[model samples]
Target: MASTVATNLNTLGRTTFIKNPSFKATPLNAYAKVLSKFCIIPSIEGPLKVVQQIEQQGAQTVLETVGLKKKGYAVKSHTLVKHNLATGQTGQVTAQDVSDAEYLAPVTIGSPGQTMNLQFDSGSSDLWVFSSEMPADQQQGVQSAGNSIFDPSKSSTFQRTHGTWSITYGDGSGASGNCGTDNINIGGITIKNQIIELADTASSQFLSGSESGLCGLAFPPLNTVKPTRAQTPMVNMISQSDIPKDSELFTCYFSGQSGNSYFTTGYIDHDACGGATPAYSPVDSSQGFWEVKSETACINGKAVSRSGNTAIVDTGTSLCLLEDSLLAALYGALPGAKIDHSVQGWVYPTDTPITSIPKLEIAVGSNYFTIEPEYFGFADLGNGYTYGSCQSRGSNFPFDILGDRFLCNIYAIFDQGKCQFGAVQRTSSGATTSGRPVDSGTESSTAQLVH
Candidate 1:
């Protein structure tokens, strides 16, 4: 049977507090995609619940959710809608589709307050920070967060139950845990009593990378990970408690500013970024990723159509990629772009960089957006390896991922409650073209490299 839960994140108030779009210099968000496990697993054990007691402050049971993204199907209701391809395992969407979709904030391990780093993800939803006992596999080169680590032992309401959960990202990254509890914090706000899946394996890159464990603050019916497929931590916590009932929408503003970024609950300081909150499209949850209902796709201003069903909006991703047909429609416009079946992805000659590719625009709820060029480019993939949006990943590529490089010039807002994304023009405040507060735009063209 298909598993599911609901996200209590409903956008209630729409208000701004501060506007500081001017920052000295900030870090670029890396949304690298790696392969991950996709096939579904049996239901996990127990009726997912979050119990905060003395022994363990808070612990959340993650719901195992998985899907392979490709050319044929689409997620319409929790059910898969087969398009041209029948019995196809994966799904697909266009570049513009993802840009206009609503998304959840990258949650960290800390109290509601004290949220240090917030990550925006498109591959996985099992948002969790690490606990002190995190197995050596998880510890690895990563040291303990010390005071920041969710100290389950400190919570008087800690409960030990058999909570099994697993997450395999589209990028081949994953983490798993039996069950654990620590103070679950989000946006500097505390979920007083809660439970989370304690990752016991090598989660160093994710857990302590910057903030605490992640928070899958998106749509729910979270993935059921264990043998009995139950509710996930976020879903169960909101369901079991009366806290979210008073809320019509739990909105979050993920400030992807250079540093000092945060997850603002209830209110988003639109002025803080000197950016505007564009209209957000309702979210498509059946696909397991942030999917938006789009009306069009135009290469540099020309219109096009897509054969796939969903678009994966990933901040962790780097470029704007598309499926075979849609890409053909795009590269056809460029001077040197073609599909290389040998490599199973798209490729373009270095002779041409921009392909003069027009701004791929996606429309949501009557709002039209033009994806900027900053999202396209060749990057050092490792071993001096490099690739470009004009290129494709080998066969079985994740097909479509609207990465951060595209949003640097334009503002993208994830309004989760409305199940929509907000896109606005990215202004520099006359700052540096390097996305820094300084003046660097004079050095080169407006096309800035995220690296």
Candidate 2:
């Protein structure tokens, strides 16, 4: 009577409590609280790399610098950390640091791809490739074949799907164009017939950085892309194969700026997932997002539990932020904990004594894990006047991100293809599925197939 996918659960069957039958499906479609914040409705869009840069900039001095000028509008500026590369894959924390590796180069109508990384993004649904269609004036500082733009003409999988796709990010950055196919090879996993949302915009505003193009990881209400002037990330991936369709969820490791990072598919590594494990909460199918049901939050060894809150596991977000009153109450437990609330939210002073901070724990699937006290301080918080704290956001009610900050403490898996998250606690003990030990702590596994 058991499904083949259910049977393939490996050791996780006995380890995780499958109290909710829906867990076997796809990721929990919890309502995305920030859905309305998406004024620019994603046609499809959008973390980390904060460590080595900080060390090179002098970790102490970097923390103290603040004063947001008119450099530009920033939706959210988080201190990105690091996540490790899977077993045989070689990963570089910062793209520049890995000069020798062959990065993914997206082509424009004008020429072929020059250099780029198979960047992994779960934030928005649109994908852009440098294009030759762009006016000659805007294409400076970058090189592409004359009128050839890194054409996918050579790849057998290459094809142009008619439609104009574009999307603007919360940060105001945007990209647009048509759709194309290519042989996407990364981490040794190749999706030979991968369908890519090729946004060959006449302009290159969004395509001007270390990143080349993005591989979207979101599943629904999100698949807006259409052949008739619309396209979706799900549509493209689904067309490629049923692999993405088999599951109900998809996740991004979202490791910040410390270690190397990559896009993990098929299942979530148990050990990589962090946060406390709480009693099984109900899933709100209508709400959307892989929303988990949690009854309360445990703050610093105290019972500061409450209900009606969802932690969004977005690869798009770089930092973790809880509600104001909740964070205050939580930080209230710490010594000399003064909150800087000049902005819509609050930020903790870096000089605050770390010892005074209580261990904050979040209970997820079947275990409870504590978020490191250091991750809470500003990148410079807790260090003296020499280091400056990083920027933060806490305006959203009951908002907390299970991002790289928390993930670094453990190995996690986003079984987005399936609605469940297979997390391995005590991963440092080496419980791994990638043929290696769970580098973080305890956890690791696989899903039959989904997304």
Backbone N/Cα/C clashes per model: 78, 97
CA shift of 122, model 2, Å:
2.9
lDDT of each: 0.40, 0.37
CA-only RMSD, every prediction? 13.6, 15.2
List residue ranges in candidate 1 displaced over 4 A: 1-32, 37-123, 137-140, 144-151, 169-173, 203-212, 225-262, 272-277, 336-357, 364-366, 378-386, 389-399, 427-451
lDDT, candidate 1, 1-451, per-residue tens: 1011123335322222122222111111121222122221101111111111122112222212433333432211121111222332333211111111122333333333333232334444555545556655456434543213444565555565676776643322346676544444443344443456666664333543443455554455455445544433345445545233433233333334353333344443444335333445566666556666543455554444332334556554445545445555666766655543222344455445544644555443344455445445434333322244433322334334555555454445554444555555443342211122112122322221111
Candidate number with greatest TM-score: 1
- Cα displacement (angstroms), candidate 2, residue 197, comes to 2.3
Candidates' TM-scores? 0.59, 0.58
- lDDT by residue (166-263, candidate 2, tens digit) is 55422223455566655553332344444555545532423333344554444433433454423333343345552334532333332333334434
Best by lDDT: 1
